[model samples]
Target chain A: MSGPDPERFDAFDARLKKAREQRQEAPERGAVDRSGMGTGLQAGIDVVAGVIGGLLIGWALDRWLGTSPVLLVVFLFLGAAAGTRNAFRTLQRLMEEGDRR
Target chain B: MASPLDQFIIKPIIPIEIAGADLSFTNSALWMAISVAAIYTLVMLGTRQAALVPGRLQSVVELSYEFVASMIRDNAGREGMKYFPIIFSLFMFILFGNMLGMIPGSFTFTSHIIVTFFMAACVFVTVTVIGFMKHGLHFLTLFTPPGAPKAIWPLLVPVEILSYCVRPISLSVRLFCNMLAGLTMMKVFATFAVALGIFGFAPLLIIIALTGLKILVAFLQAYIFTVLTCVYLHDSLHLH
Candidate 1:
């Protein structure tokens, strides 16, 4: 075949350049970009889930052993403490990831 | 119209009873099998031709491979690459399960807490085992936050242990709630679409938008699940 047309090649080069520029500008389009809102939500979930999990386990234990509210109260506080710690740890990790970027 | 929640009913596909334990293959099990098969086809057949320039199928396979690979690298480092198969499989299974559930009549396995919890428990157990295996009793140090006051060890240790224990619950709940909410929202909107008759177009538009969001959520949840697994793996491998 004859050599490729310069006009077609120029158009292709421009298109490729534009695509590259777009890709660079919007590199955070995928899962890599963890927004503040997403991080906050995840942290919130971690905390809440921790507390709920602890409460359930504590209540179940109390029911089995007939300890009334003692275990429930104790575990509830422990769960909250755990939840808070989890939230803090999650936030710390997210911050470190952000700093690395 | 059927209740939106009705879609999640786990009716047995092949009812089987052994010693009074229901070991029947249910809809959830069926869909799980389907998801596995779908992923196998996509990954195995899709990348069969290791071409210089990938076709559509090969591109998808490569993209998924790189996505999980980079995720593992970023969060867990090169050492974590050893568990790539497990993480990759988890991602694809959840991704496909969520996507497949969006089909009108299909069951959403991920939406069920039982299913999600089972998967999450597996990850938690595996991670914990790996940590113990690699570090033995030193893994207990994972609970001790560095630089914390020695006096507060009593308070900090329990909290750390509780949080560690809660990982499976949180992991499972996150995926379950997201899938459940998306499916519920779609069902409620579809109901409105039917009730509105000609004016159903408004709800239809919302449903379409919701479906797009659900798709995004599906992919994001899978990524989040995998990334969190990597994070836990990192913690296990390199305790602070």
Candidate 2:
């Protein structure tokens, strides 16, 4: 609701962002957003999360529509894309922050 | 027996037809409005009472805030904080859309290729502009992998261009297809669970498992979309 805070990210580069979310206080979201190997790990997390989310609705729809897998397939890809995209942004943000300083 | 897919259709409440184009606003529009309102209210309500100890609602709100904020911090950095409005808004939008679709008789716009594609396109185009603006034509260098032999430039360049152009298409289709397919399978399996009488419990159980997974997917998908935007932004700005 409120505008975002205008602070830059932490001092760590891709490495620290992956090693631990200490951020100095980098939470899971922050961890995922930061670059490094963490992005890959987070990307996997993203896909699984999406598939889980999609399956629920797909089940409900199948019950309603009598069509299976259509929604499941569609939403799964959606989740994967969503996950990959998130990782991409996190990597860039970290790089940019490093460059800024 | 109404087909579930029928419900996904975008029928116009207020038809807008122009020059052989049908860009009508439908119940989907109504639901989209509702989703936005619901997300805004819940988030604001959650954050409005930011607590030291944290209330139940506030905790959940904080989790989301921290989750997304951490994501930006992790990926975008302190500077990425500047785009919080866009990132946060985008996350909430996807989250609400996904969650709302989980409800019965709801339209899953994200399941539609057009909708997801457009959303992805926005990220792709915006990131490109940011890249060009920030780094000038040097961003073009992103097409060339650093270690590639110079002789292969003619081949690799086209492939790179193709991949870059396909970003939004891949991004959007992935979301749309995943959502649509997942939703469709769940619906179909549910029918089996019911039609098989007591034996339907197996499918039902599977569906239940899928449900839990889907919730994770909802948040993950939103996170993924936003983070990708950040990554692309990073690439654009740091092309070298």
Candidate 3:
């Protein structure tokens, strides 16, 4: 049995191509609206993750060194700082992408 | 009625023990294998006939190829295509895994923190190794932000290191939480539907709506994971 007709196949291909192009253009216009909430959530997670990671590492170091509260206190501040910086960076990147678009 | 969380139970089909290790093949493993097999069949068989005028499956395959190709090009540049296979495989695996999990009674490996963390860790390690290999000790300069004063280097370095160290954690948590939330919501609604008996119409409508949302979330999470991987690749390769 013969495959699909050549002309019919070409017409279908053209329609698919058009649809794909439309999708491609749609994202550019919708990027901010689409990712607004997602970006905010990601930034929040980045900050939280940074702080928790730092706290864990610092607490472990304090336990190992027998320094008790000193290292923990220091690391807590450091972790907070790190978390803030990460949040800043994330927002910066989002802004840059928005500007680029 | 069965507990909603019972869907996630990893019951072993063929219990096996090797050298005192519990290496039994569980439901999660079975679903993972199913995902891989499905992807293989879709791509391999779908594109077997490379016709100028393609069929539906061939169009899907081609569109995915172009989608990922443009992603890499736009994010990581031409040099990044060397890692295309890894990125493409990652995207397809997660995409298929997420899509498959939407089916009732199937396991979602991506919903597990351990699995997502493992994949994130792999990406983190690979990117770090690539950075070190390409730039030698200069890669250490990644910790130092440009235009920062030398006096503040000591303060900035630790913060940068801390942020960098938490990448895998954040990446894994993002995917895990999203998937778990979607699955849990569906389960809760399903429970409501059954419990509501004759007045189950409202819960049924909500469940239907949620299924559509879950499908969108699956695609979005997969896309996000792949895009982040590309971003990491770009950062490591260019030191930006």
Candidate 4:
């Protein structure tokens, strides 16, 4: 046979994309609950962890560099900012997942 | 009355010293061994028959397989299926640990930050290695969002790195905190039930409800952990 028609291949590609999207959009069975309690707990953990992680890293760096309180204060603010970013990203991901379901 | 936190005390069953390290077999280790054995037995019994018409054990095994498989497929796409063994093992281990700990007087190893942190760190290291392997130096670009302003790259990159580095902490802390809080609350309420005597039924009722909720949390936390692993794996494989 000669080369397959280009238009036909395009049509098939579109159909395939549509099918995949549909399969993804269908709500999965036995899905874990992501709303209410789960979301709240997850966001809280992300924020708290971000802050704690930043603080520890900052404290250790300060001790090693003999910078005393300077790096500690800067990292403390950075840690809070990171924590907020983490919480925002987590919520955004959950919201996108919620939309899909 | 005993303190509610007394249940978490790790007493050595067999003390062994190797060099400077204290490598003692403790209650926590015992419970972990038990959880592993239980999981192995369930899988062995479930698959021993390998029948066309499934028995109860086989059904449970098959259901768990399907659940994890679908979760991977959904979150990570087709390429992610290659890491099924690690993800499945994690799911079963945590699920088994949580469920077994529900039994009175049993230790909950997952409640310990060290254990959960170790697991999460392993995941973080594995995913990072895979990302670097797959994309080489380009993996560093993961810090930068697509189509972002170049001027803000310095500020944004550190924040991105901070968030990235915090994954293991958040992952471990989430499971640790949940197990710790739930088990502590249960113990405290049980203490209340005993102290109240006849009115023990009030706290008893609360404990009953909390038990059900705890079971749900056990499963949900396991699922959440596995799902997040898949998401991270997907990120490594396919960047943003």
Q: Estimate each model's TM-score.
A: 0.89, 0.68, 0.88, 0.91
Tell me the interface RMSD of model 4, in angstroms.
Answer: 1.0
Candidate achieving the largest lDDT: 4
Residue-by-residue lDDT tens digits, candidate 3, B63-153: 8888888888877888889999999999999999899999987899899999899999999999999999999999989999999999999
Docking class of 2: incorrect
Report how large a share of the reference interface contacts model 2 reproduces.
0.00
Q: Is candidate 1 or candidate 4 better by TM-score?
A: 4
- Candidate 1 residue-wise lDDT, B75-156, digit = tens: 8989999999999999999999999988889998999999899999999999999999999999999999899999999988
Rank by DockQ, descending? 1, 4, 3, 2
lDDT (10s digit) by residue, model 4, range B188-212: 9999999999999999999999999
Error of 4 at B86 (Å): 0.6
Q: Kindly list the per-residue Cα lDDT of model 4 for residues A1-101, writing each as its tens digit.
A: 58999999999999999999999888774566655977887888888888898899889999999998888887777777787788897898888887776
**Candidate maximizing TM-score:** 4
Q: Residue A6 in model 4: shift from native, Å?
A: 39
The DockQ of predicted model 4 stands at 0.55
Interface RMSD of each: 1.1, 9.8, 1.7, 1.0
Q: Candidate 1 chain B — worst ten consecutive residues by lDDT sum?
A: B215-224
Better structure of 2 and 4 per DockQ: 4
User: Any runs in candidate 3 off by more than 4 Å, and if so which?
Assistant: A1-35
Q: How many backbone clashes does candidate 1 have?
A: 0
Best by DockQ: 1
